[model samples]
Target: MRAPGAALEVALQAHPDDGFLLLRTARGAGGRPQDVEITWANPTALRLLGARVAPPCRASDAMPPDVVSQWVARYEKAVTGPGRSWTNGVHGSSGHDATGSLYSAAFFPADDGVVVHLRAASHVMSALARDALHDPLTDLPNRRLLDEYLGMALTRIARHRHPVGVLFCDVDNLKWVNDRLGHAAGDRLLRHVARRIRAAVRDEDFVARFGGDEFVVVVQDLPDLEAVSALAERVLAAVRGDLTLDAVSLHAGVSIGVAVATEAMTAAQVLSRADSALYRAKRQGRGRTRAFDTALSREVDRRLTLEADLRQAIERQELELAYQPLFDLSSDTLAGVEALIRWRHPSGTVRLPGSFLDVAEETGLIVPICEWVLATACTAARGWVPAAGPRFKLHLNHAACHLGDGQMTAHVQAALDSSGLDPGRVVVEVTESQVLTDFDEAHTALSALRALGVGVALDDFGTGYSSLTRLQRLPVDVVKLDGSFIEHLEHRDRDRDVVRSVIDLSHSLHAAVVGEGIETDDQQRVLRDLGCDLGQGFHLARPVGAAQVSAML
Candidate 1:
């Protein structure tokens, strides 16, 4: 057998990357082993002992007292007797101990002493393991690790009968930032967002980036929905705070969807529930948190059904338009008809535009649906023979999808050519919100339509950011006052004053004003007395089919 000192010397010389140490048993006065003395150590071992200590040192002299105690406890089992072969896994503190970097040590009995091998635990891990478990950008946990953590949380809940909550956070308008500033700004925004979220959650909570401006948080052992909601609100507030990246003043908000697992649920189901709630928050306008419930689930299921049906709705002839007569208050007669789209469901029920228009817009179905409405309305207008007042006009609403596609003029011209309706008598109505969202695009589209001799009317005019400055910037031929303005017009002076000012502004712009949702003669009289030009509502005439419209004419 090699001598004790020779064994340690050969091991230290051969294994330069790992720390090597030879520890001899030191006994007390009663011949009982009291502790182990570090008889010899390699340069790597001295380095692992930290720069504060020298080579000839004991375990207690080299490491923290607690770590030395742990090391002694672990080595006691290995060094039972002389020539007894034993081994143990051990840990010790290293010089670069910011996060408490640890060395994994294995001790083996050799030639009346213990031979110890030490390596940094971090280096012992494979690169694939690190990459798979951590996000490369933010160094937070990735989706794979998230799945594991969420699954374990769910399992714990099942065993302990507690609730597991999750918050799915989505960055709103990230695409806008990416398009406006640059992708580099967008990436920095995401990293800052990740840090903010990490700072918001508890030390025990886990956060993961689930790709593309989406993050998932695993909240374990939440007691009830209130606790879950409170945590979600905290997370939202943390994410919604001001952020500036790379000398660019950027504003971004997060919409969070929350779900809790109190019963038997798979991780995917919980995530899907949260995702569905996120859809609701985004649909209701962003920067809010929504919790998953039975009603939302039902609504989601119904929307899914409607979306599938709407894809084939046009081919099935399930779509048609109704005309509501717009009256010219000055002429005291029917002025124009607004085409409204309705869906004839297979269940023998009629669905209003509100029931499915949002779904249509989201699914890109609004494009073809608007085209169809334009063609049908032009055809009906061409067939109409106005015997009394001026030539009848056909008013149709333009979807933002149409404006954003930059094809509004081509679609309008095609409809006119196919139906032979005069472009001078056709009015394409767009809402103020659409203009606000994509100002340049909507402006270009509307300007091009006006150049084609088609009049452009601003629908729902007073609801959004419709300042006089913005209104004057738009090249509109008419402005339809939103229904809210006329809802309380009989009582509220504020409503009346707003309508009066808008009327004056529109007239000054040489554009006519139309009051929508005029449900009473009193409201109509008030609007006309306020100098409103034209009006359309249930009081004027409810939306009617082609035959009813022809009869009314």
Candidate 2:
């Protein structure tokens, strides 16, 4: 008869599946087998184990740490116990099959050790691969897969000379939903939106959940720009509606930005252009679509440069306050000044608030910039002596984003305390639409400021939708009529009626009225005749520096 080892090797070589022979080692401390040595392996097993090896090698040296531990325990039980067979689900971690494949490993007792067999689980591997590329929440392709698909589309564009369009979709008011409703509701809304977008697109198109509240769609073989626009419109229509979440009704909307591929553009460039157009759409107003154009590209570049420069404007002391004098129409004397922020660019050009305020608000630079304005204005007002009254008011415009938060009140208190300026002599100016955006939060914020003895002025009145009752309920001390109404005040009867009605209503509410943007003498005269209490416009005095304001006082 042949030897036991030689007989076993001959049988393993004839076996079709992967097989290994592990020999038992003497127990070190405990009354159990210490380890297993890899004494023999077939050709198939050698491939799985990474290389051909001689017998009498430790299993730890041949297999991964985790794999060795599992096999060693089985070897100990098979050799030390009642010589029973065992089977286990093991993960392959060696060279050739290291893609985290699941394998069924069987161990059977031999003369002095155990023989092992491994068979892969193909279905588990497929599921793992699928889960790697899909988002768990929406079951849509994730950013990683989106990038891969976008690359493929770009390649197809180059080869086939066909246009590929990319649509960047951003969900509007998702944050509001998340804040008011629960996160579960938000997740449900996202999943619903993903399904709708997928249903709205063509079968060939690819849709993915790019990130939080944002999705990207890749369309291949688009013929023209109009087709891309039509697709965007379809997506918008599909997402726009009332969604009832947990017994609460909410409106779902999305802003889409579209960009078509150029032969010279890279995948990143195309996506970036679409993102730029999406930003433009949001700025114009959400729930719309915008296409990328040459002009928009230039505008985006300019805005980016301005944003970068504005981030450094405050630190470099390039920012300064320009005081536009607010005059009392009754006495024909200076009553106070509205503090306007100016950016003295290093290029020797002075930039107005309109030129960069939007960027400031979007980038969240407005918070710090506004704090600086408050502090500087209060300090400058400390040196001014009123031309007629006990003390002239300092009107500072606050951004809408800064309102509805207690931080605004804290900023005002700190400014007054630091500058030693009287709180009663300070007026915080906010637009009408800002107050109406979230009336309750704005009310709470304004009430806190009022408790500090600071006055509130509703700037840009008549420009937004506000009812008489809403206006009456607001804690406003002064109502400044918008510049548009004053622009044609002398010619338009409707403008006159609006102004007269506002003045009357303001007086009834015990609030003062100031007509804004009085450019011509006729406009100022008409406003004064209509019983306007205060006036501010270029006709009276343009915005000037602190020294000029002091001289005027």
Candidate 3:
């Protein structure tokens, strides 16, 4: 029976200001006791306002000092009419030092003499705010809190104000921890974050967790980037302390990104710069700090966007394949076509593999992208094979991870059969890196494809890890020399020597070599004279779809 009222009380306590809104009030001085006062204000604000807080606290207590001034200034206009005037300044907790977040304000009646009404609802509001501003597990401020502080801090410093330093830090692979140990263990690691973060910064400096394992330290009154860098180093040292997980000694490192407050920037701009610097440090092999710079931000941002764009492309199904002809150098005839995946965006722009393939490889989307490319290319090949002539080939590059895919062998067989293209007419090009990463799987897949009577080419041969070693054991039939090897033909001592060795190596292994990037007749003549068996480049024929190939053949 008491539960109903208790719940009501809890609700009211949660948002005392709602009482004014929920309870009907009379106009002017003749109103009832509760209705006469504002509803949201509560004991907390009443205390802050230097008044004894009463039952059914009014909502007016949320007003801050500045807001109270505005109200008092506008009191004449408000009391002369019916509607309440919204206060501007919020009343904040006395506990707030410089970095504190919650600031409460109130709605007050226009009359100067009208009693101040405090609402109990601000407590509820404050609780909700605290939750939103902080990470649940670590109870540390997230990016939002950092933004508010950095904004105010910079604002204060604008009029020849004091200097400030910020340390942006990231955890090295919390994902690995979550995967290997468990969420509990990951939470435990994050729980110890504050102490380590604090230990790295001075008492006067500000610290907050950005998210997951990333944190930021904003230090006011810093002289320059050098001082800021010192804080980053300290943060690295502090977080790198050995951690014990299930009786195992584990070491964790902090990749600190630092951005100092500047007069020309907003809070968002400064933090963004710091994030860029942090990325640079991570790229430099983690466990260190890098100062923010414009060039660094651009490169990091470009790579970051490329990675993100590649992932989004998969979800959006925004990829296509273009066919480029492989020339038989001796006959000057188109022997086969390389099936290169291109990102044809919904936005109507086309991008080459170089723009995003590395991102695909890193994020493991290479497998799916490769799968889509092979299937689509084979389908197109089937449509044009009869008209384009017999034994025309579509060469598709496979990634290091694709070999490990359980259904890839099946995917290949299906693509070939469905397209009505013979397995012999399709060439599976495996990049050197792919073969090295999972040798056993690559061997198995290649052997299976060979059994199906498909042609397989080892791509970018000289660039892979132990290419020659792989050749001896793998089921490779052709070797496509990477373009990097072809770039060095002019210097015989270095470039020519490397090319000669690779050619000799490929020949010794009995694998036909295809020189890529033969843009000029000189490059082509030189490559063919050097005993290269096949060639591919613009000078032969640029990559084109089936329609264009119709005219060429």
So what's the TM-score on candidate 2? 0.77
Pairs of residues clashing in candidate 2 = none
Q: Where's the lowest-lDDT run of ten residues in candidate 2?
A: 87-96
RMSD of each: 13.9, 8.6, 13.8
Off by more than 4 A, model 3: 1-140, 143-148, 173-197, 233-254, 264-269, 279-291, 296-322, 328-333, 339-379, 387-391, 397-479, 489-513, 519-533
The TM-score values for the models, in the order shown, are 0.71, 0.77, 0.53
Order of quality (lDDT): 2, 1, 3
Once superposed on the true structure, which residue ranges of model 1 sit more than 4 Å away at CA? 1-125, 132-134, 155-157, 246-250, 308-315, 385-391, 400-422, 438-445, 448-453, 487-494, 550-553
Ranking by TM-score: 2, 1, 3
Number of backbone-clashing residue pairs for each candidate, in the order shown = 0, 0, 29
lDDT of 3: 0.69
Q: If both were scored by TM-score, which would come out higher, candidate 1 or candidate 2?
A: 2
Clashes of 1: 0
Q: Kindly list the per-residue Cα lDDT of model 2 for residues 434-490, writing each as its tens digit.
A: 987778778888888899999999999988878777888888899999999999999
Quote the RMSD, in angstroms, for model 3.
13.8
Off by over 4 Å in 2: 1-125, 385-388, 404-407, 490-492
Cα lDDT tens digits, model 1, 141-248, are 999898888888888776799899999999987877787779998888888889888998999889999999999988976798779889988988988866776676
Best by TM-score: 2
